[model samples]
Target: MKIRSRRFKHALASLSCAATLLLAPLASSIALAADPEKEELKLGFIKLTDMAPLAIAYEKGFFEDEGLYVSLEAQANWKVLLDRVITGELDGAHMLAGQPLGATIGFGTKADVVTAFSMDLNGNAITVSNAVWAEMKKHVPMANGKPVHPIKADALKPVIDQYKAKGKPFNLGMVFPVSTHNYELRYWLAAGGINPGYYAPAKGDITGTLSADALLSVTPPPQMPATMEAGTIHGYSVGEPWNQAAVFKGIGVPVVTDYEIWKNNPEKVLGVSKAWAEANPETHKRLVKALIRAAMWLDENDNANRAEAVEILARPEYVGADAKVIANSMTGTFEYEKGDKRAVPDFNVFFRHNATYPYYSDAIWYLTQMRRWGQIGEAKPDSWYFETAKKVYLPEIYQSAASELVAEGKAKAADFPAATEEGFRAPSSDFIDGLTYDGRQPNAYIEQFSIGLKADSKL
Candidate 1:
């Protein structure tokens, strides 16, 4: 889809959507300016391109429209961000999808963090250092002069074997213990028969490299390229603009994106403490309302505002990467090596495919990953997955925001999920391993994996 002038105007229409929504009947649009439990808010985020929704809501005046003044802060790391939100220092944050689930399940710092809005989908990639890529390139199939992509981890297995044969360990980095990056890296390596290791949190084993081919650990997102260049880790799985930063710096090549692993996979979300959400229900709903408008602006008319969005994200306070680096993935194309650019329009999906809506299947998938890698440490009934998803993912709040947007003519009913949606996506086999997953029957889905524990299997 081309970025056109008319669509740019459409993208900016959300500016007026807020003002128009204010004039709506008192019976309509649920936001009451007089009734917010709180107005001024502080939100936290790490410096990644997928944080655009929070940035957009603030910069575009969407928050002000809801009678809310928002202050967006960049946190040092995922743990700090989650801790701040949990401690009431920050009202909410851009969080990994697994953060809420991991918190609720007592995987890490146990707090009842919950998300009403899913921020974006598929903004991550697994990148290998130049030396590793040089060795792996020999095993990758080539088309013309470029290596065929959606590169399987099979290409890296030989390189790992060479490292092992030399009595050196091959290490990789993910952002956090329960991050989607860790799971995606594990999934890719396991699909190639390389054990990315496992966790046994029950036994106080969270190093995640108990029985491993490539030992995986945590490195903050901004530091990934530096860490790889310093020879600390061979590769990393992380969100943009870190992945694109590696390509631009000529230090590493992104082997495969998460999109290639699972098509339209859910990624980040806006998480707040469950206690905070319960105390300020109206404020939470209004915040989600502003974010939904921002998402719609982002994806309207095929991402027509993306260039403008890139410019905004490049500002010092937001993602703060070079605009060119951020645009590598933001503008509908992703560069693998220096010049091997290919169209991946959905690489940084903000709203398309109903990306903002929280789904039960999305939560269950993360829960399954935790169980598969032995983080959960025990088998549970399928009903537990469903109930956990309900507690963490607040689809009802999203519906309130969406309905308000519709009532005020700010969004069309057709543009949102059906009111009757049961909160599950149709079962999909869109994984790199070619296995289907049905959220309703998590045990059955777990059984389909060739590697990793089945429902009853333990570490």
Candidate 2:
């Protein structure tokens, strides 16, 4: 309804634009291209602050600028969101970075899902209950009467061992089996010599607790605080608002952020079925363009707009968390322990560091984690990794959309990766364990992980 009223106002203004356009020839030449194949779209998202791109695009009229009227619906959970996208119940949805790759590879629900846009980076943290934190705090190194930053999983390892000694399951919650939260949590735990466990899908054991020292299960993001409070789980790995929710509730303390786990790690993406993309290529590119604009707005001027963006995300139609909770991390700062707020401007990065680029390296990293954890039961060549990443992460589509924006002078050419980019990021040793990852060499990267399945290893 708001979009309709906005369109009506635009129509009224267009009647007076002819005279102005005649005086400004450059503006007339900069007009948008043909309308999208599908003008009306319903998109889906989970209730997380990282979904800010979709909310901003809708609220700021970016979608309408591309001649698209969009509806944003919050899904019940990740699985339902992915299923709806596959079934075309929604045009596209905000998805975990691994969802498209996982679906394409037949990990859970086999389908040809693809993404042309990455939504954001580094918006997750691992939090522990006050009880767990109390025990873990004894192991953590302290400076200035507070736990040192980037509290390694080694501190939590002793607490997990104690729980095992008592014969109690040390369960943790991630949003989904193939979620970035699952892999990031596993990575942090394994880096500390704790086995977060393996998935034996080949033997029909999809639960990833086969050899885990800590059992991990899926709990929806909104329910993480309540679940940890109920003692059903000791801690959780999740996106913002929820992690901050735990601190506000005073039931838990965030131990480490994903930015500390692996700096600027890819988090979420805009996913659609291959069928929908092929059928509406123009519409797909237009959608990516609008989302790109939204992301730029979110991170521009050193995040000057983040406060207003937080207010929009706090609305009932979006993330719906209290504005204070969303602002805790969204406003360029993260509160770990109570009264321990620290500056982490990149914690919820939307566009900076080329955050919106759908890099094949990012996709291959997820595949490497899946293989390392045994969800990918067998090993594959590096070539397979590259090919699979290309199939799912369509950087060409993203580049096409970005080029349009640059041509329109809405974004600078330097804001995106070069056209000659081969889709892999440069090698980096940014993990908590300081392991180097070269996306071009997936098997080598997988072999470097001591706790996971090594090269050619079978479950």
Candidate 3:
């Protein structure tokens, strides 16, 4: 009986050992399952503080957290960056929100580009050259020796008229034809009763000023201040540091910010080729995870890390602008006219308010703008807008990363859109002109705009 009992005990111990072995592989599989795809990645960006999330993700090891070895490169211009992404030279890029939409729609280049992340909100401002600002200030309203916030272009209308009467064009610069700077500049100018003009690509007039009061041209971000200083352009609309650079060099005065034009506006996005995304879905999700973490770090605690972000952007590899220049708008205050500083806490929002999610509504808005201004010549059905937005903004891929973050307790459900979400935002009326925009009814929205081409309207 004693021998039989000892044999029974040994069998029980063996069963326990077997159970431990079974559970060990399960845990190992769970851990190994979390590893990233395509461990090495190269990303591109223009020299704007809006690209800080990419720099911060790399610098703070967020990419490493996802097992991604990322190399962030600053390209010469937006065109080069977009081309590189199309050709696989860049895995992804910090791009204009319109860039992916434009590329997918074959505005400049034919490529299937997608954005799962929006890099930032409201990092652009319009600045006028010192000479033009001097003339504009004479017409602007002042109280307590300060120009009122959101100094409208009404003040500059007469200056443009002077140029018009003199038979010389009133030239201004924006980064790209489909850029936020282009649209925002146009919006502000149109709102203040300035004719920013139209694009007739079909007519071979890509200059975008068929009949104009102000001839808006495309100048790359880094060239804005230098172009203004050389008197080549009277004013420009651009993202970060460059606007403040105008103030530092005494070349120009920033008249209004996009935040003032449209509060908390979506700006740049992280774009990748459709081929890259399809071939390496896991790598794409991992990249989104790293960026989302970096964006959170940037906006956490009411932007406690903004100082560090400004420093990172000032480094030669990122924005490469003067630290003081970058700090002007990056650290919660923006310098407009020389020494005229104001508190703008949300000037460079990165993560909060669902800023990282690539909303289909945001994509549709850019497309609507393109259609409104003759970039898209003919009227497209509302379904076309929805289809185009879905093509460019991949909410499915974004949700994958968001789900992983929630499961790991890294982020909360409240931080993103609800688990069951419709791609479109509930009709946004937040534009500068207070025009209600229902992405579902894009043609109606385009028709309501006071300026540019509308439904059945051609350049």
Candidate 4:
């Protein structure tokens, strides 16, 4: 009887040990999935297709999966969106890659804005009116009757000269002053030897058209086509589906994509006020995790899921454009002329090439553009550029969220930068003019440009 009792006790102890072993991993996962301090959130976005990660996160239950109930609202414009985020009216929003940097540095509205996730890469193009295209086409090289790709700004310089000879101000449109569109347009024109102008913020001249060749002004993204159609502007730089919208409406020809201007350039980011991020650290991480998952779903299987993504983006609450128009650029092809669709698989990268990671190098590039264009107003040390990038871009938060996703088996570890990544990318001359940009050497990179402010240059 004593032997049987002892055997029963031993079996019970073994069962208890096995149960604990099984529950260990479960507990760790639960800890990782801790309740977010703020469960209900309102986020804002503009009506652009690159806001896909936020849309995908909300549509696919990735937000709910992370214990977040998010209401996605489309703001009227970028300034309004930034203001709302700054006022805590919206928890976060899809932002231009330069917006946070601009805000943090007191360029526009002084606010402590920061971004943990880079939303997408290379979704913008410069579109010229049909009339402008007709004039510019004469200078472009022909390939079997179709215009040669990339259509450098050199093609448009003579056209600008014609406008100048006629005494008409050569005007162009960019979404915002600090936007990638503005810098890209300036870069392309400067590369072609047309001065895009400068901003003397110290003199309160934020007009950015001092001593200009091509006068640039702000036009909201969705209104780009109509504004150009009204002849208010000759050409504009903006993101999809607006560029594609021009092709569909037969209003303009997308001469060059930002992908052509600067291969795989960072476009937009997921931005929130620094206070919000500090107040809800857990929520922020969960938000990033959901977005990371959404991005993975986006690029997985060679973008096999893009068709469905286009459908979601076409919904009235999101981009609200026709599915066909959105799909023109979203699904690995971009329409230049009405039928000049070409395969550009990396045109709208969300996950691949560490697109989701907020590299410091990307931030510094925007800073360099600001300085080059005089928005920064003064030369900054290379260390200052690095420090400012560190202030605005939170890679640690991204890594934390990514690590959780990898541990939970939702994402592969290889999908992100290695653990030793110092948040800088290797130097490459990916610009349309073949100028090398080493993020570590900002002044040297700035000096290579002929048009804008040099490293020691003053306004």
Candidate 5:
């Protein structure tokens, strides 16, 4: 009887040990889950309407809800913003979509930057000085005594030619070399039979003016209108409210919005250093969640909150533009010629159409533009584009944040791309030029263009 009792006692002790082993890992995982590694963060942004995601996230308390106390600073310009992110002076920042791709590939600065959240879509436009617009208006087709919508670069072509006829340089301004504005301006010019020029980085010519019809240069976003007004640049492509500021100041006329350049194009993104992301995984994911929520709020009920957003963006500490100027684009209308306000509800998309998701295809599109110009300086296989895109765009982190939003009932699952989405959007031909682009076929897409470098054409 004594031996049997001891056997039972030994069996119970083994069962207890097994139970503790099973429960221990579960407890550890529960503890590790959702807790931020670093809660206090310093984020940077340029003063643009698209920087609204970070602004909304802060003013709306999305960061604090995740136990993060974030301090937002307005960087002087895109270069300064990118530099701060690279040097760890900022936890993350509102970045041009191409900024991360440009940095990773050694275009200007070499850094391992990754983005999971795209800040907004279709916020940029091409605006010409009043004097330039007067010449352009003569060539533009009109309707009902008003200039027609989507005034293309074809209209500006005659103006550029007139400048060339008089031995004058036709200068255009873009935000950055690797910026979407740069690519869009070039695309518009090339489509209209104008040579916007090329960058032969390998040949030590960053001027991008080899056999060019229009000279393109970088002007800071805020200074763009003033620079154009000063006659330093005849026209400029930049994000709002500067374009609207031109009309308000009676200094310029916005010729085209980026929506007409590339319909539903991906614009700005929230970028972080790869090292910072790895070291603080939880914090990074939570920050994306906050940004996602902010995006959703911006687009909720088809921009019901935009008036509030415009107010927030107009503050001196933020965009610092007049509320009316900011509202010109933010509130579903854009002023082209001072009084030519038209409805463009998608003018500033924050969340709808999966704008927040960082797709590898978007990265590839930017890279193809870099190569098409002279920034890439060489021809690479399509696989190289794919691999580079995956390395730079952290879609896995986007999924994690999106999944949390869906699970908590904060957002619907249908609002995100399918969990099985391959990070490439369907091949689209929605640009003003009507050129179809398949991200999977970068080389073929390059061959489609009449101007710019081709697959065999190297700078």
Candidate 6:
């Protein structure tokens, strides 16, 4: 009644083999779903430590893991970098937080630039030439033989007034018109009752000093020290190595960092043209994921990796300055006067304190500053500010990339903004003057400050 044992065993083995073949494609489909659309990419950056994320991402193979090949190149300046991205000569770039907004609004160059990734936070300082610092030191308050921290612009205002009364222009340098340095410098000067001038687009004057007390102008970041040394500018606001270079050369003293002006302020961003982003959405998301990983690496272990990062930044193509000079600020310490080094752990934050998130509040703050200085030229309704911020900051893109990382088990949910995030941060009153800023009520916030042109005010 029984069949042959060999034939029965053969049939059972054949069925099991078929089942294994059927399930193989299911697993393969899961793997293939995670691969990036485009594998090769080109990104641009300036010679600054904040660009460490791009370097780290490329060196650490984070991009490779995402099936992306990336090349990091240093641009001559912010303008050239932004221009390349706009013209599609580069895929994206390490950008000034304002670059994307400024470009989108037709400030300097007209393009639809967008950013989902903020590169870092609080990596800039305002440095004054030694001669200027010596003159202002008399007005600064001394505590325990050291000038008080967050040295107010009040001290510098008197020095500038002296220059003005003597018929000399009080010139200062910022890297760009819409740069954080320009806004921060203007904010500090305005807080101290110094009019930093205005930008009159209607009058064909973007010089930003239409009846001003201090005439502000643009100087490339690396050239800040030389510009000041040549007497072309008396002071400057720029990202590090340049500021620290001045101190090492016995040329200047850094009065304050952007952190003191606006705590944990957003600095640079990963900028790309809106057209490029749309055409290569998958590639853009993969790029963001890799950058987020690099940012976490930069800030991981409380910046234990900064010394190594400074070394990488010191190479010729990168910052190209002495490691010691870059380390002065990169390693959680900053020197004020010669030999006055102090701990400022957040001076160069890359990822912590929500540094990677491109908050709508941050964009609105810059917009308010523009309006304050007559850059906007007229009263904009609160809706216009919010809409403009939304146009430039692509939170939706950030979410897509973060979700992909989570799905791949490469990142955790806690590492990113919550699903319930409203894009805007809570109202903050952490300014140097203790004034409150609410992104939703920008005009009201602008009116709270003692200085700056308000709604409907022109130069």
- Top TM-score model: 2
TM-score (all chains, Cα) for each model: 0.93, 0.95, 0.93, 0.93, 0.93, 0.93
Q: Which stretches of candidate 3 lie over 4 Å from their true place?
A: 1-31
Candidate 1 structure quality by residue, lDDT tens digits, 206-313: 898888888898999999999999999989999999998998889999999999999999999999999999999999999999999999888888899999999999
Global lDDT of each candidate: 0.91, 0.93, 0.87, 0.92, 0.89, 0.87
Looking at model 6, report the run of 10 residues with the lowest lDDT sum.
1-10
Residue 283's C-alpha lDDT in candidate 1? 96
For 72-95, candidate 6 gives per-residue lDDT tens digits of 778888889988998888889999
Leading candidate by lDDT: 2
TM-score of 1: 0.93
lDDT (tens digit, per residue) of candidate 3 on 295-384: 999999999988888887888878889999998898899999898999998999999878898888888889988887788877888989
Q: Worst lDDT window (10 residues) for model 1?
A: 1-10
What tens digits encode model 5's per-residue C-alpha lDDT throughout 1-459?
002223444565679978888889787566445679997688898889999988888888788767677878898889999999999999999999999999999888999999988888899999999898898899888999999877888888888888899999999999988889999899888888999888887888888788899999999999988898889999899999999999999999999999988999999999999999999999999999999999999999879999999999999888999999999999999889878889999999998888998988899999999988878998999999999999999889999999988988988899999999899999999988888999999889998988888876775
TM-score comparison, 1 vs 2, better candidate:
2
Q: Report the C-alpha displacement of residue 277, candidate 3, in angstroms.
A: 0.6
Give the TM-score (vs. native) of candidate 4.
Answer: 0.93
| Cα shift from native, residue 325, model 3 (Å) | 1.4
Residue pairs of candidate 2 with colliding backbone atoms: none
| Model 2 weakest lDDT span, ten residues long | 1-10
Give candidate 6 misplaced runs (Cα > 4 Å). 1-31
Backbone clashes (count) for model 4: 0
For model 4, how does the per-residue alpha-carbon lDDT over 1-459 read when each residue is reduced to its tens digit?
002223444565679978889888788566445679997788899999999998888878788778777888899999999999999999999999999999999998999999999998899999999999999999999999999988898999999999889999988999998899999999989999999999999998999999998899999999999999999999999999999999899999999999999999999999999999999999999999999999999999999999999999999888999999999999999989998889999989999989999999999999999999999988888999999999999999999999999988998889899988999999989899999999999999999987889998888
Q: Report the lDDT tens digits of candidate 2 across residue range 410-451.
A: 999999999998888899998889999999999988888889
